[model samples]
Target: MTVCAIEMTTTAPFTIAADGSYAARLAGDGEALYAERWTLAGPEPYAVPLPLAQPEEADTELLPLADGRVLIHRRVAERHAFALLYPTGAAAGPRTGELPLGAVCAEEGGDVRVRLLPPSPDGRDAFALAVTGAGTTVWRVAGGAFGPEQVARIPGRCSGGVWLDRVGRLLALDHELDGTTKAVAVDLGRGGEVSPLLQITEASDDRLLLADPDSGLLLIRSDAPGEPRLGWGVLGSSLPVRFPECLRLGDAHPFAVQPGQALMPETSGVALRLPDGRIGLWRPADRQVFRFGAPAGWLGGTGLWSAQGRLHLPYATPEVPCGIVGMSLPPAPPPPVRLDPAPPTPTRPIPLQQAPL
Candidate 1:
């Protein structure tokens, strides 16, 4: 069995699309960043740029659309700002207008957070998480012709949220209630009823990083191992395996995974930045860690997990502008383990509090 890989050199970082068949890059020079969208279905990847323009600074957050468009978000004062970027090449070079997401969480101040959750499994709409004074709200990003629709909301403080399904029908939110923290599943189509999703034991702190609704596979980060480390478990099949805490030391974010497939042999896992300024990969299933043999002086931050279970990392050396290495992986068989649900351990009685950010 052969797994295809894609590598390219550029000046900007990239985020892969949900299905792993596409990648989007925002190449910036000083004040401006251009978008480069690559189609990966064929042997050769064809790329195109949006109307060259500068929106936010280097820290601009990006979300790739199902139809090959790009979404950009930045915080402007107290409001969450968003703009829908249309690739000019998709319509023969004439760039379409950027759709205004307007101000989300405008009334909420102090790091009003907004995040791009996993897109719909069918490659249709994308979802965004916005924290406002009212509560945590999830908005569906349909397209240019339509405004974002609020599909779900968590009544109280919610953090460490992740999609529980690829179709985005279900979402898991980390909730702190009665002085303890655990994750709860929210049915967007329903009344957002909160149900226990992940809780190893009330004695430990845990949160879901990525979860596959079908396989019940979830990549979790928990303090159960005595320190913050990687833990993975199947919903109802096997016990979770926890890795050493050092695997996540100096890590910028949790491991990457496909929106639906969570773990795959050929896909990339979490990227780690060592104390010596080196980077590495975390394979929880293998219980081993390996660093990328990237070119010297490669900057690291976050990466994308493809549907094929491959991790796509963005790096830049002093000599090269920007590029990506799609770490290849042979198709791995499904994990044989499962986690049996157990009654949650009891925590001291206290007022329900929001999980810390």
Candidate 2:
């Protein structure tokens, strides 16, 4: 789907805000984790002026707070602790004291923690579906205010979850039970009750990629479609979303889009397996896919969508170790007027694997 390809110069890799104004990165000093915030809007962009410094620990995971602070999870021994960094200087740029996440979050054990719960609609509050060895839990993280507070703990073992509504009220999580993965919804309004969301009659992990509240549109990649191809399903609607077997959306952002927020809705650039397994972006909106001539060692081939629907992907050439770049897609091309063309021959419905769809 070639419209007009714009040049994307490489830069640092960071998690961008809803509007792509600022970016955040997790910096580690071997013992401590630092939350580095940069203003990508100013002339001198990517400068980590106001950095949040966390207490020294063995390992740390950082998530950006809406108010520019950070929600830090520090792993000291077997005890799992949470803290809120104010990001101080003139602004709250860095460092923190102990602000435990109560008794529930004191253990960050097992295979996974919070995977993707999407930030609040206005970027003020953040929600996450935290998965531990015990079970999966939902936590509400508010920047500049409180640490991670338990909203509700889901039933059974699960991978992660996504927000289904614009106001961050509804959530959909991938629950693993009985040797199969099912999409279940945990209605926060209903006291964290779990109900079936998307279910396939097979053993597969159907993770929610992006759910657009404005249109109730869902993009999911699951092994149910033979080999985890990109498929569409509508929220609150029982109708199944079906796609051809030839398409395989490569490993892209499986994280949920922020409430009333999307990196790119109208168009998306997904990673794909092409040109000797190089990273590529698949635009589902237009059924067009393009590959970038990025140097080897791209950031795990995960593509990001910006506020304006621009594609920001990490690339590393031989000269540059790592950097991020944004691809501005031109408007969708006009459809060609119909003229009766020769009918094509029928072919077998051969299933194919497509990554980054």
| Top-TM-score candidate index | 1
RMSD of 2: 8.6
Q: Write model 1 residue lDDT over 212-248, tens digit each, in one string.
A: 5544556666776566665665554434444444455
Assess every candidate by TM-score.
0.71, 0.68
**Where does candidate 1 stray beyond 4 Å?**
1-13, 52-54, 76-78, 90-96, 108-111, 143-146, 238-254, 258-287, 295-357
Using lDDT as the measure, the top candidate is: 1
The 10-residue segment of model 2 with minimum total lDDT is 343-352
Residue 320 in model 2: lDDT: 43
Q: Taking the tens digit of each residue's C-alpha lDDT, what string does model 2 give over 161-235?
A: 566665556776778876777777777766787776666545667766666665455667777756766676545
Error at 193, model 2, angstroms: 2.4
**After aligning candidate 2 to the native by TM-score, how far in Å is the CA of 356 from where it should be?**
22
> Which segments of candidate 2 are over 4 A away from where they belong?
1-13, 28-33, 41-44, 49-58, 90-118, 128-134, 143-147, 202-204, 236-239, 249-278, 295-308, 313-324, 333-357
User: lDDT of each structure?
Assistant: 0.57, 0.51
